[model samples]
Target: MMIILKSKKRQPHQTEKTIQILKDKLRERKIKSKIIVLENIEVFLNEKRVVMKINNWIPSKRSPVYFRIAERYKNASYIFSKYLEMKKVPFIDNYHTFTRERNKLIQMFLLAIKGISIPKTYYSPAYDSRKIRNAARFLKFPVVIKLTEKERGEGVFLAKNAVEIKRILGKNKGQEIILQEYLDNDFDYRILVLGHKTKLGETRTRTNKREFRNNACVGAVEEFFPAEEVPSDMKKISEQSSRIMNIQVCGVDIIRSRKGKIYVIEVNFSPGFTLDEKMDELNQTADYLKKWHEKKY
Candidate 1:
């Protein structure tokens, strides 16, 4: 069996580490696998044909298994996934799921529709002052302004009042931003769900005194806990959120409010694993792939 790991040109250091771990595990299992950076692949289209070429070689339709790990090259990933689908191939975390989870507005909408609790969020394609003001009216002060396409808390901001909201909107005139009710909490949970199981859970607390965001990239401290130690409600909601998003493996971010309400903040398609948990997560994923391959082939 051949397993292909597909990603974009530049990936995170942690992503590279996870790839190496997966490769090592697959090697030990004696499975043929390779990492195919989507940037290196070329697609050609014509009135009569469609072709995908990589390094002057055409990949076979028989290449059945694939795992997509990045969304930076979304168009390419979509085309490649369609090709594989046309050939009746199997892959982990299909293109639709990847794109859906990447969009915060769409993700929150879907989760809310599935009866999962999410913070009050407002989104619009065009930045409208009326919409912004209305969202502020509904959600009140201390709302979070998030760029729809950003991750790792890159475009996240806290607006204490309408003035801050207007200023933020003015600065990002053409960009798509969503306003969410800020849950006044010191920490949030990041739950990694694999298959139908919750593999690992961690609490990320802000290390900086002035920072409101609790992203690990922003110096948030992470403490991993066993699955049983996690709140039963959190595990259930995390798994349910992933299922609703059609993600076989994902990281679900859940936040608790000062009022003791649990809300799902985000669902990540390609969540990073800590060095200590990388081996275990990769091995579990490999075992899942093997079982899936056996059942299919």
Candidate 2:
């Protein structure tokens, strides 16, 4: 069976490496695969029929494809996924699940409603000062302001007071921001879940002493740990979060407060992988897809 990896034209260094690793693993299994950059994709509908061509080549309808598009191109991804579904092509993470999981606010709302522990979050697109002040009052000082559409800790800010909050809001005018209760933790865990199973667990700690966000893109270091070393509760919750999001593969970021309460910070549908752990994740993903292809075809 053919495997297609869809991603942006300009992917980060790590993302490019991860894609190469996945391609290699699939090749080892003798599965035909190719990478399709979304920038080169064109979709057209004529005579009540959908037509999709990637770099002037139409993908086979029988192949299973995986999307690696980032949040910015989510709308395109949604449209492409819908076309694939209409053509009865197999793909990982449908459009609905992909779009919903990309929104941090929506993830927290859905997970919180299901009794999953999440940091208290408030969002407003209008940037109303009264609502901002109310969020400050409800969540208290030292709140976290996160841009709803960003990833890799790009637009995360810590506000110690209303003045700082106002300043941030002013600077980010017209942007949707979510105010979350800041949980003071030294480090957080990034648990990779695939096929409803916890495959790999890692601890992300900020290498910069002053940095509160522990993202590898921003000077954070990641170290792989055995699955058994992770807390049972964390593992269970990570798996549950992925399932609830209707995602087959994801990275669940969980943090533990000083009081030992576990709170899920975020769930990443397209989680980054380090050089050391890339092979393991790709191998498992390939095996799972192979099995899926066997069962379906």
- lDDT (tens digit, per residue) of candidate 2 on 4-80: 55555466798788888988998999887877677555433212233456645666677888877677656556656
The lDDT for every candidate, in the order shown, is 0.72, 0.75
**What's the residue-level lDDT of 30 in candidate 1?**
85
TM-score of each: 0.63, 0.64
Q: Which ten residues in a row have the lowest lDDT in candidate 2?
A: 42-51
Best by TM-score: 2
TM-score of 2: 0.64
Candidate with top lDDT is 2
Q: Model 1 over residues 1-297: C-alpha lDDT tens digits? A: 565656554667987888888888988998877776554554332213444555444566556556664545454455556556655667655644344334776676566545688887765434446656666776778989988778988999999988888898888875656788888898999988888678778899998999999998999998887778888999899999888878887889999888887999999988876656455556656777788789899
Q: How many clashing residue pairs are found in candidate 1?
A: 0
Separately for all candidates shown, the number of backbone clashes (residues 3 or more apart, or on different chains) is 0, 0
Which RMSD values do the candidates have, in order? 16.9, 17.0
Give candidate 2's total backbone clashes: 0
